[model samples]
Target: MRILLISVNRERMPYPVAPLGLAYIAGALKAGGHDVRAIDLCFSTDIEHDLTRIVEDFPPDAIGISLRNLDNLTYPSSLSYLPELEETVAIVRRRTPVPLVIGGSGFSLAPLPLMRRVDLDFGVVGEGEGSIVELVGRLEQGASAQGIPGVLIKGEDGFIPPLPLASFHAPDRSVLDNERYLKEGGMANLQTKRGCPFDCIYCTYPLLEGKKCRMRGVGEVVQELKVLQAEHGADYIYFVDDIFNYPADYTAALCDEMIAQEAVVKWTSFVNPRFLTTALCALMAKAGCQGLELGIDTGSAKMLRAYGKGFDKEDVARAARYCQEAGLPLAVYLLLGGPGEDDATLQESFALMDRLNPTAIIVMVGIRIYPDTALQKIAVQEGLIARADDLLEPRFYISPLIGSERLIETITEAAMKRQGWIVPGLEINISVPLMEGMRKFGLRGPLWELAGRMRRPRMRPLR
Candidate 1:
């Protein structure tokens, strides 16, 4: 069976991301003895021309489209990718009559809504590596894909629960042009693990990857890093795990393995402050961790509890101190205007950032509410959204107490006073041209450090 996998993600605001998920599915299919070809549309200038050429040349038996994001997630300047997705689907349909399948993090979030919105034969809810192989095999056999787990047929009322994988497939990085991503996107992405155990209210990671953390073997991770460096000329890597520091023992072992194997590749990942320690921080730095991004969500203790972050301000401070002592740059992410946001809580966040002085402070104003999250229930109870709202159009929950206008004003004012503070919500800084110019000059990794070198001038909030 010849399978055509298309990555339909084109969001390149802060930086473009290569479709690691699609590559995993392609790897799994190839390992299962199926011919797989992949196309990344992130840098595609003319989607119709490129897609038409591919379809004409390969003429696939089944086509799988990966949707990474439904919207930009930035408030005020939010852009929906649905139109682009529809355009891609239409182009593919006109080119061939092959089965169209959609599955990715974005489509998995609202599979039913997306299915209704666009014309698709099937949708895979959770991890598609296993399900996609089975789907393609079934289609090759000319059998009905009625009972496959995680496979949703067109016009189906309900879907079976997605099966959990014990381990991940060795992603076929060759399926896409990784060298281009390294040059344009700043860093190549790899995942050391899957799943999240945190109970953050507005998060969808637990829903997407279950609560259990599945760690890849340390040796395999190190080998993949080596391959990325040797075969692809990738110097910097960003681990796309939901939380790379959870299961502290596994993280420590992985870092040690990287050191033992002498992979010598610079990397960064999202780290939870709760499990971070001085020893672990030092080990990570020794293992070539260039930077760390902490999803602190908020700096106020009151808002931390309200947001179900499971960690307090003190934990964040301790983590910051450990990173500082280890000489590892830290980037802090904050999500304000949630359920308990107010002027005082906002002040607390700014004060904490000022005191800790991380390498970068990326702040977002509103919480994008998704279904099956604690946030969705709270939004319904508080009358922010109705029970039946599908939330497919990117509705955000901004605290009525703080108000959107005032929250933007306050954050913009505070960010202007500090260096290394970025507010994508305002669309003030981190332009694409600026990032491209930096990457062309051989800058790699998360360029947030350089992006935050100087304080940005005040600009009108994005309307």
Candidate 2:
């Protein structure tokens, strides 16, 4: 089978993400004895022309498109990708009659809505690699892919659940903007693990990857990192795992393996405060971890409980102190004004944040409700949304008690005073062209950090 995997994600506000999902699917197809090529639209100079040329030159038996994100996930600024995706599909259809299939984090989050919104012919709900291979094979054979796990056929009633995320497929860089994404998108990313065990209310990890944590072998992860460092000249890497510190033993082993391999690639990841410790932080730093991004959620334990966070404010503070001791820059993420938010809770958050004094704080006003998250249930119960509301359109929960106006105002005011604090974020201070210009001058690892460092001189002390 001849396959074409297209990545349609062009949103790079925070940082452009590599199309690892598409790369994996391409690898799986290739491994399955199929000829595959991937086209990434992230750094595309001309998507329409390139896509047209590709379609005309190498027409594939099947085409799989990956959608990493829908809206920007920002509350008020909700920049949607539906129009762009629909246009992408229309362009492909015009060029060729190949069967259309969709998959990715965005597609999986609201598969039904996406399928309806974009009028998709086929989509894979969960894991894409194996499912895509099977789908392509079935398409090649002109047979039904009815019972294949993770395969979602058009007009189908149900889908088979994907197998445990134990198997790993290295990305197919042959069909990627590999070097460009590695450099401009901040850094190369390696998934050391899949799935999350914790039940966070607004998180889409569990919905897309499941609750079962399936970590790859430490040695395997390190080997991949070494290859990225040596072969791709990747100086820095980002672990795109849900919880890098979870299953403490796995994280410890992975860090140890990186140290053992002498992998010179510096890395960063999203760490859950519950599993972080001084020992682990030290190991991470020794293993070449330059910084840590902590998903602190909120500073008030009351709001923490409402957000379904496993760690409390004290635990958060302790984790921050551990990162500090390890000499790691810690960026704390706070999701405020959700189910149980008020002025008191907001005050408590800022008050506790002062105590923690993280290297950086990223604050978000409202929590977006996806189809199957606990936040969805809470939103419906709280009358913020109906149970069957279309979540693909970016509906958010700001807690009627606190109100979004007040929440945004408080966060904006606080963020203005607090250095290294970004309110209503998922953004960057510098422009893309300026960042790219800096990247050419050999700058990397999130431009926002530099912005944070520069702000210290002008930032006023929060009262």
Candidate 3:
């Protein structure tokens, strides 16, 4: 069976993402003896032409489109590229009659309605490796897709039973042999584990990955790092796990293995605030971990409870202090507006930010409601949404009790008073001329180009 996987993520944020999910699925299918190829729309200039050519050349038996994100996942708005995705789907459909399956970070979060809108034959609810392989096998065997686990069919009477998550070794990077992309500012991403133990209600990770956190062996992780460093010349890595420090001992062991193997690649990962301790921080730093991103979503205890963030306010502060004392650069991520978040709670968040003063703080001020997540339930119950099934126009941002715009204003005002605090990229109100100038030149282009004149460096006057 020949499988063609399409990654429908084109917008690149400040961070570097390598579309590991799609690559993992391709690896699994190939491992199962099925021919597979991946078409990434992120770097592709002409998606339609490229996809058409691939279909004509490869003539895949099944097509899987990985929806990496719901329009960059920026708060206050869910970006929609439905028309573009639909067009790709149409092109694929027209060129070949292969089965179309949609799965990825975004589809994992909102599978049902996204499937309805995109006109995919089916979609995997969560996790693509096992489900994708099974789907391909069933289709190959000419078996009815009726009882396939983790798969959804159009007009199906009920939801498909979720498949038990599969535990596999670190992905075979050899599947996508070219490692040059890693050296070109892309983080060699690795997921050492899946799922989050902490019940952060606002998060979609726990819901998507399930409550039970499954991990790959520490030795396997070390081996992958060694391969990346040696074969790929990967110097920077980003662990995209839900919580890098979930099992502190396991994390420490992995760090030790990396150190033992001389895998001295600079790395960064998100760690749960409550679980991280001084020892853990020290171990990470010694293992070449350059930075730590902590999910200190809020400082108010009430807001924390509302969002089901298992950790308390003190836990965040302690974790921040520990990371700081351990000489690790800290980046704190916070959500500004959501249920039970009021002016006072928002103020407390800022106060805590001022007190902790981590290396940087990122403020996210939008609520995206997925079907199964707690936020979606709350949205439906609060009349913010009509039904969970009506995912056609994904709606988010519940500021009715306080007003979403007002919330943004307050957060912006508070953020402006502080240094090293970053807001959502989409929300930033840059001048149109400046944005046009950025388009003329690359992101790292000289400011003098946009300034309309280059002031040559002048030798300082002799004093």
lDDT of 1 by residue, 1-463 (tens): 9899999999887888989999889889999999989889999999999999998899899999999889999887788999999999999999899899999999999889889889999999999988998988899999999889999999987899998788885799889899888888888999988888889999999889988988889999889999999999988999988989989999999999998998868899999999999999999999989989999999999999999999999999999999999999999999999998999999999999999999999888799999899999999999999999988998898998988999999988898777888788775556666667788888889888888775454343422
lDDT of 1 at 112: 90
Q: What are the per-residue Cα lDDT tens digits for candidate 2 across 1-463? A: 8888888988876667788888788788888999887788887778899899988888888888999888877866677888879989999998888789999888888787677767668989788877787788888889988888877778766677776556675677667766887767768888888888888888888878878888777877878887787778788888888888889999998888877878756888889888889999999999888898988778888999988887787788788889999999988888888888899999998998888877777777688888878888888888889877878888888988889788777887777767777653433333445456667766768655665554532322222
- C-alpha root-mean-square deviation, each candidate: 1.6, 2.7, 6.0
Q: Give lDDT for model 1.
A: 0.89
TM-score of each: 0.98, 0.95, 0.89
Model 3 residue 357 lDDT score: 79
lDDT of each: 0.89, 0.80, 0.73
Worst 10 residues of 1 by lDDT: 454-463
Q: What TM-score does candidate 2 reach? A: 0.95
Between 1 and 2, whose TM-score is larger?
A: 1
Q: Rank the candidates by TM-score, best first.
A: 1, 2, 3
User: What ordering of candidates by lDDT runs from best to worst?
Assistant: 1, 2, 3
Which regions of candidate 3 are displaced past 4 Å?
174-180, 183-185, 425-463
Model 2: which ten-residue window has the lowest total lDDT?
A: 454-463
